[model samples]
Target: MGGFATGLARVTTATILASSALPWPQPWHSAGNAQARGSGRPITSGPNFFTAEEFAMVRQLCERIYPQDEEGPGADGLGVPLFIDGQLSTPYGYGARWYMHGPFVAGPPEAGYQLPYAPRQLYRLALERLNAFCLENWQKPFVQLSEEVQVDLLTWLEKDALSLGPVPGNVFFELLRANTLEGVFSDPIHGGNHLMKSWYLTGFPGARADFMDWINQEGAAYPFGPVSIPVLPHKRDEQG
Candidate 1:
């Protein structure tokens, strides 16, 4: 992951530098501010994976994971749910990239994912069972629960104390947590981070061409605002 992170930074630097050399439309941005001009645009696509009820649940879950505070926008507002949905519609969601065939061993914690369900299936089953459990206990769906109750339920999920049908609660919680972070921080071109709000919050120069000169400045605030990979329809499809 560290290697990947370093590589991504390098790629970002190269791409941004090359793009800057070309005549391209650059979205105006400012440094040290969480908000960027023309960023944080509203997500336009409808859910391709989750139904309305489930999508609502996902939205709530994601926002709860990274709620709106004095810092900046929360997950749903940043399209984290939509990002997960978009991811589910791709090969990644189907687990096409993984070696699904198994000797089926759960030897230790060090061993990786041994679940039978694909990522898409896990989401569907988890949401359905969670809603059922919530209704049984609280007379409502998880999405309809109050924020306090929702937080309690999420805690139970984190502790693996909740049973949601065939899907392990802890596994679901882990997946949701990971996906939430990915959606919040990943490039907006991948259907999350809606306008690079998180980048701005973290002082990440998203796609800004040249920051080589500023690399030596430690503990100093970035002067140029973050940039992003401009979304082109074909590129989106290709990446997904």
Candidate 2:
């Protein structure tokens, strides 16, 4: 595999392992939400949390982290930005499930999510700082930068060479990177995994309840397409 594919494999592997340890809530979808299962339609509505400028920057950032190549469609094509937007509108973005009160001292890496800011706040603060950094260095915003420069900025962020004010650049990079993978591999009802392309790529048997018949066939390639969770539409008001 090429460098991009190798890196993507590592990210995807790590994401899968991490996801298995988390308690994922069922997603609620509305009729107005763009369905990406079989249609592969892009989300046309504006973001719920990110402003136009912030959204544009995030879209470019995701694209750079997982650019389209001969392997398959990348983050932008999978509607990862829309997935992130949807997530930021949910309780997870507000850190509702976490224990927020704290002295907020720096903890070891294993402590996990010691930051005071919620996911939404992290994105807002980080994006603002990142844009300022780009304008200061490149005379433009992140979205306006050339693709090569975008990749360089992302690399710097990943390596902690960049800092986003109160938010560490590496923290923001991991958050964005993990979210991008989730958007690519998650069921379509959650606003990504458009047409189950990632599933096809990895030969993942999605939402199949049971694949026991093939369990005994070691090393056998399971000849089947992926099945996504059924999308049940609810009224916008009823979502509450």
For each predicted model, how many residue pairs clash, with residues at least 3 apart or on different chains? 3, 0
Each prediction's Cα lDDT score? 0.73, 0.74
Compared with the true structure, the alpha-carbon lDDT of candidate 2 equals 0.74
Per-residue C-alpha lDDT of model 1 across residues 1-240, encoded as one tens digit per residue: 123222332334334333232222222133423454324334866788899999999999887777765546678778899899989988999999888886766556688788788899999999999999988998988878888778777778889999787777988998998898788788777778876776655656677777778776755555565677775766655544
- Checking candidate 2 for backbone clashes, the offending pairs are none
Best candidate (score: lDDT): 2
**Candidate 2: regions farther than 4 A off:** 1-42, 233-240
Q: lDDT score, residue 35, model 2?
A: 36
The TM-score obtained by model 2 is 0.82
Q: For candidate 2, which ten residues in a row score worst on lDDT?
A: 19-28
